[model samples]
Target chain A: MIEPFNVYAARLLPSQELFAQGHRACQGCGPALALRYLLKALGPETIVANATGCMEIISSSWPETAWGVPWIHVAFENAAAVASGVEAGSKALRRKGRIPDKKPTVVAIAGDGGTFDIGLQALSGALERGHDFIYLCYDNEAYMNTGIQRSSGTPFGAATTTSPAGSKSFGQKTWKKDLAAIGVAHHIPYVATASIAYPFDFVEKVKKAAAVEGPALIHVFAPCPTGWRTPSNLTVRLARLAVQTGMFPLYEVENGKYHMSVDLPFLKPLDDYLKPQGRYRHLTKDVIAVLKKGIDQRYNEILEKCEANHE
Target chain B: MAKAAPQSLRKGIEVSISMAEAAMQANVDVVAAYPITPQTHIVEHLSELVADGRLDAEFVPVESEHSAMSACCGSSASGARTYTATSSQGLALMHEILYIASALRLPIVMAVANRALSGPISIWNDHGDIMAERDTGWIQVFVENGQEAYDMTFHAFRVAEDHGVLLPYMINFDGFILSHVIEPIVYWSQELVDQYIGLYEPMLRLDTKNPITMGPVGIPDIYLETRKAHDFVLRESKATIVKAWDEMEKLVGRRYRPIETYKTDGARILLLTMGGVSETAMTAVDALREAGLPVGLVRIRLWRPFPFEELYEAVKDCEVLGVVDRCLSTGGPGGPVASEIKGALYHKDKRPKVVEFIAGIGGRDVRVEDFQDMAKKTLSVADGAPLPPFELVGVRE
Candidate 1:
């Protein structure tokens, strides 16, 4: 069973929209919405270092920008490293009395490819160094900005342009890399997984990450209509279904302890989540069964962690 | 009114340590670097300075040279006086970000302990690293000795941070040749350095109160224009570069120039070089002069804007110019610097007969005799003796 949207918490969210509209994001872009909620949680006193990806391109076209707060986009693979510099620079300036003493939150934003693949070393270095910053990886599952190429974050049996579903092939060969678990392994103060469908919950996690004293990482599951071959308006529904089917779990790891943010007694059917997206249309019953088994095992492991944390 | 020489200390210090002390004197806000051979001592000493509270800055010991440059881009973008150091492979790793730093007009000062790039993997002194970055839009300068390297650190920061010239700067000194060798350096007091460099007041920065977007996507319509603007700023920055050097000379009484000539009066042959090799080349010119050969030496200090006028003025009267390059262009012209020199003098009416010599590669010692050999070969070529397109000096068959 899954809980409905909490009206009380939704009303408590900050009203200011830091991520302005009139941008070039695709219709119903889940990552755009996630960024909207993230900036709202972080508020105006934030500096964002974004990696080269869909969000960076869509929001930061030349001579125009949707960011109401200070933002910088450096390159494809060094957002965490750049943000570490920004945080350190800000701290140094404040300590040296160059800038005002107010502590502005520094945020690094990247795509799955930037976080899990090419940028892994920089991300690991930043987290290990414990820079007082937040790193948010918006996972749309593949390199959607580059026309849906396969990435390490692409799930098994899912068809992308590179991982086409065809005869003698089962689409992507490997399971999705558990980035949140990797973040937790860094022994950071905060690590969480979020979904765009749960706006209030996602905002809360961003707030918690902002309040943390050291490195915090939030792996956000964002659905891409263009990449997934789903209807433009079904981005939010797919994000919710992703969570309900245990495809992505909404949870947080605080200082090595796990707790489920949206605790569900039982997951909905995987068919409900996989059927709407054309990327998984070629999955046979055998492949579906294999994916189901993997999902259940991972979900149970998280449950075990959450239960162990209670003790 | 001339200011009295500020209280100073003369000490024999390693070039790398002196350079680090110069950065501390400049009061850099951030130092992000990775440890690479021949460049390690500079960053290690910087980290020691930060750890010991001698330098009040953020010392980021990044994992790789790529991240080191990337973090420098960030700190510099945030309006901090940023410094970093690297060599051969590390500079190669930073090749991608080097362009971005200049394109975004971030005034980052980087010290490159010049070392040879690898196939057999060398950690010794050469110009291969910085030569590969010749077109990266950074204001590149070559230093001959420890004192020059230390003084140029302040000059680089001042010129790079000039509001009209917000481009990155590279101070290139030969690794191990200059970096590891200890030389007597006259250090400036903190007050003098503070007055010279001043505070780095950035023209633009990431600030919440004044929200701005940096590194925006430049589409086809505007990308060319942005690149043109960057190029224009780099060309125009020569004025600020000269002005800064002149001001430093007024205070320190140590003069510098884009191109410095030695014993060139009434000379028919000239040897051209950059970095520490110029010192050796000068000795060879003295020997040639004693032997009744009208030979002279010309050293390039500023490399980026190319200093075509200064170079032409220095060598137009000479009959033969032996251009000594420390790195090869490999299969095409045999030498990068010699090729550029030929190109710079191509249209000149009274240019010398240029001879290219690739020497001192991968830390191979280029002695005074080697330079003399290059001059004699150049003189032969000038006298219509046939020779190869270019010669690689001191190479075993």
Candidate 2:
């Protein structure tokens, strides 16, 4: 039996150490923490195909790797395909009495740039092939690597390199892509959006995704200090504000059923999630209000879907 | 009866094809490729074979050229002996992953109906596509006709999967010139194909039980060393390629050599080319010999590890060489072949003054007259006359 869910009380850290501390992860890098929590849920049986991103570079440097189990660092775009190969390869090897384990979890770690952009095709192929694997996209709202160039995942009205605030204003004119919705459209066994702000919800989704027999996608809203332009300490707080305000929802889809994991009692203003991030520092109040309009539209859409799915 | 048997009679149909029939006869697991002009006939025939249950294969109808190659990569990487084909822009679109295929050393083989690259969008014959991808680290083989195309695709699997190599190979044919043009070809029986090529049970795969990661990135410090390992394997695999060919000959009754020599016993001039263009040089060589000129023709098959030792022996008796590179290097001296031959012959005790020509770019059809002119130009260069420098043929713009 478990106690009534409280963020502090729900914290049940695992005994097995799949992610070692003192290994490089940016100060409060959400993806790194996501990795930590994901590993906790997965225990030591998971093998990760970590893509090239802020977390991969910082943690898996030359001297040593933060990963405690079997790991591979493939190129940026082929993480999903590589993971598919690993899953298929491992199965064949085991059946032939080559590898000892009868079953092992395979997961692919991709960033916003990798998942939303360059790696989309490979992801689609693996998912369509119905490969047994979990693909996690740590969305920090922009391409944090390469000094934060604008990616398709970057939010509207935010100033990025390509979408900078100029005389024309409205730094990024395009709204953030509804990646979780797109995942749902894949008709996968499981598709969910999880935020680091709610670690327990995120971990539950990870465990669910890992257990599914076919393709599963977990879209995690991560906060970056360098790209988000927030202070290191404010990363988690901002992520919390994001979910609390409904700007980033904590939800899941198990075989096409939509369910909200985090039930926020009181919603905060969207600016609380936006204010500390340097990526959106240039946005005027008017622009922020417009962004709120888009977020409202999205939340309404998600709510309607939840209603429709339940009915 | 002994007199009627004739001195040296070889039946044309008794010769095995190097391209089309190998996959069908081998009962390949998958054959997924888009039909781009010349290569279409090959796959069309292959498709019919699969439909007829002659070849046990999954002919996946993919979305595009990229998907076709991607499907091959996925299928082959998953322990299936997969086959695919492309030419020119189709090849160009797969450029990004071509490197990946070789780097992963996936042992996938593709037939390129060697069409020219686009811009003007010509659909004729040229080495434009294959030449551009020379350094892609694939064991590239240029066949003179349809026969070699069928043979090499079969041998490619053996040579590629030979744990010593484990690299992908590309068999190049001069698009419509050879790919669409067919001749009587002997089909190897399935049992013989099995005995010759052997069954490839993969040593590694993507499985659930023994989980392992494939295609990992090595950071800067180890990147160069990794590249060096790939290069060394590519070089060392040359011996294995030859050995595979010799074994193939015993079963199929046709032998293969990297560099082929024709009438060069005491020749002074050697005419060189690849693909269907070799026949043109052979014609020009006959004419040169008719005119009492000491000329020979050396046709190159493998272009990647570059049959250096074999080429040296082939051209050792020659003084002046005429090299035709259908694709442009675009910079430095002239065509790619001209530069390669120069490098190979640089330290020789007695070397030939190789005259290079860039011909048939963008599928400008090269005629027999062009070869005759090429041979005449070679003789002019040999005679120390002011050569029209190494010219780019059929250029009007």
Candidate 3:
């Protein structure tokens, strides 16, 4: 059984919103939950340069707004670029006394499609520049807005509109791109993988990302109930299972040292996580076994990294 | 009043020299670019300035045209008034990102050495690259000489970062023509530019104390609407462009208009062109007038907003138009500039029969004699076989 979201995450995320209300997001969208926790952890005085995604559309609709602080929706790929611009603009303004020195912290948010595909180059450029900004890539596995096309972030055996469960189909044939590893390779100030299943742990990673002065990236595994074809209420439960099963592990990299936030007692069967969601309903035993084998290999490697970080 | 002189000044200093010196005076914070042909001298001078500490800017040596703009984007977004230069193939490589920069509205300034696109990769002067990107939401200004390049580049920062028009801009200097060839340029002092355009006061920024969510996902119902709003703002922001130029005029004594005219005062034939080709086109008109042909020239300075009204009034009464286009429009009957020029004049009462000439493309050498050739070709068509305004000087089979 899953714990109630409000009761379980109270200590981690405050009731007050940094994202605020009135910004239009789907009822209980995973990205919103991710933003809620991220905002609480980072606190206020943070300016956001959002991209052209579901979050930007709903919150920034004219005459109605969801954000409590300063925010902008520049473009899909240029969120990191725009955030960097605002960061530079504010800093330069402060030095010249053109703007008050009390500048808000800049944070950029993008969905899986934007982060994993369209905006990848801009994100790479920002990280390379070592701009003091936090890039939050809320991975919902597929392009939820554009009618559930398979994004690079989508995992194997997951069914999407593009990767349909029709004749001669293996669902999404590729595994999710290891974005956290790529980010870590940049030797960024911070790189972390999180899930809404563990709100406190997620919040903590966000806090760590915010505190770092250089480029930081936080990837949150946000389950899409609509896109994943799962019941909305079972979102958190499925996400929590995703972690315990070693499918989407929760971990952080602190100054190049890898730290696993949760280490499971025993690996749960891959079928347990896959069976409930319609996205994975057509998965055959062979496909499940193959996925399990890859997951096991990757998990063992992660454990080796954890063991190596025995400080 | 004391310094202003004739439109033609004898063999002036190269525009690149004045551009380098203007940037030096502007006290730029960052100059990051990879040099392409035609744009080489501008960056060469910039690199030298940073090397000698003449300008206090972090000059990042980027690998490619994509990264050149990428570095500028990074540096500019970080609140630095960054500058970069590119043309032709280099500009094409930065094509996808040009839209990205404008949409993000980073307020970056790029000096574009306008060159033709490649099937044949010519490095000479043309407006193909810039014309292809006319609708990319960048505030583009075409300069005929080095003096304009010197003034426009500094003015770009003002127009781009203006609170009302927070858009990135590209100041186009014709490849080889203006970017390579030297001309007398009046260099303005930094004190005036600084006083005219103060430091950027960014509305939303990245800092530690305050945190907010940005760049969220926009769904279908709102996506089109949001894009429509952005499109509307870009088009309607023409007034802001004029206002910025006017304010800059107060500080520096020069002013800019969308469509610049030369002897259009009651002329029957009007020769039209953009960028450095305007000089050649004007020379053609002068020769035609010396032989008693009533011809004038109209130069399009601002490409974005199209300057339709100014163009309409400028060429309304003209009987014949020799519009030289540097870019091809595959789907349409002719090139991009020619098509727009014809379209803008279509609604006029005493409309000119516009003859589209595909000239100086792929960096092909366009001499002043080419315009004289083109003007003669245009008048012949106007006199008898004016087949509904179409392409003339194409590289035909």
Q: Best by DockQ, which number? A: 1
Q: How much TM-score does chain B earn in each model?
A: 0.98, 0.91, 0.89
Q: What is the DockQ of candidate 1?
A: 0.84
Predicted candidate 1 versus true structure: per-residue lDDT over B87-141, tens digit per residue: 9999999999999999989999999989999988999888988889999999999
- Candidate 3: stretches off by over 4 Å: A1-12, A95-97, A101-104, B1-17, B20-86, B89-108, B120-123, B157-168, B199-257, B263-268, B381-396
Q: Model 2 over residues A179-256: C-alpha lDDT tens digits?
A: 887788889999999888777788888989988899999999888887777789987788888888888878888888
Most accurate candidate by lDDT: 1
lDDT of 2: 0.76
Candidate number that wins on DockQ, 1 or 3: 1
Docking tier of model 3: it is incorrect
TM-score of the second chain, cand. 3: 0.89
Error of 1 at B46 (Å): 1.0
State the lDDT of candidate 3 residue by residue for B1-397, as single tens digits: 2222332233367677667767666666666666654455878888898789777666655545665665455455555677777888888877776876676566778888887777676776777778778877788888887778888877787777887877888888887767767676665545566665666654544344343333344557666876787687777778988887787666556778889898777676677888887887888778887887666888999888678888888888777887888777767778788778877777767788877777877766677788887777766765786545555454656
Say which docking band candidate 1 falls in. Answer: high
Q: Per-residue error at B69 for model 3, in Å?
A: 7.3
Compared with the true structure, the alpha-carbon lDDT of candidate 3 equals 0.76
Please state the interface RMSD for every predicted structure, separated by commas: 0.6, 5.1, 5.3
Residue by residue across A193-274, what tens digits does model 1's lDDT show?
9999988889889999999999999999999999999998899899999998999999999999999989887899999999
